[model samples]
Target: MNERTEYWWVHHDSRIQPAEVGFVGGIPVHFRFLGTAGQVRAESAELIERLPAPPTPVFRPPPAAAASPAVKPQISGSWLWFIGILLLIFVAQCSGPIFDALK
Candidate 1:
């Protein structure tokens, strides 16, 4: 069997708030949600890890933001209002006919 030493900071102190860019004792570090390993990346100054932690997962900085902007389908407000008014007209027209037929 093989065993490897791993380092992780499971929880951060309440006093030290994470930030996009910050320094710890003069060492610079950028903080962001990696969404991987689910751990914050920092210098391994402290070897101790908090209890009830997940498996020894390595933490790495998130990838740089892509230059290409994400494009999403968008609907104009005018089109939405048009559709809603049309729906209301259709319902109003249908309801009168429906009630008349039922009576």
Candidate 2:
């Protein structure tokens, strides 16, 4: 995935089947499908100001140095607070089981 460029393509190709593509910045490009041998085509552009950017294929950051650290979820609290939460969930979950067992 090139952050500096964007690309689009049709997933499947059939003989003599035309492919339709849309771009954010420029006029949509379409290729008259010649055949299975010439079905796929692609185009790209440098990230430019005011250019409608195409949707990225994947939602992931490019690997690089100086990457921001992921935020860690904090689980710090008083022991009593932790016990209370666990007890509440335990009761809620076991209430069904306890009632079923009783019957």
Q: Which candidate tops TM-score?
A: 1
After superposition on all C-alphas, the RMSD of every candidate to the true structure, in Å, is 14.3, 15.3
Which digits, one per residue and each the tens of the lDDT, describe model 1 over residues 72-94?
A: 76767879899999999998989
Q: What is the lDDT of candidate 2?
A: 0.47
Model 1 residue 67 CA deviation in Å = 3.5
Best by lDDT: 1
The per-model lDDT (C-alpha) reads 0.48, 0.47
Put down candidate 2 lDDT per residue, 26-66, tens digits, no spaces.
54333322223432233332212332454444569777856
Which runs of model 1 end up more than 4 angstroms from their true locations? 1-58, 76-81
- Candidate 2 is scored at a TM of 0.24
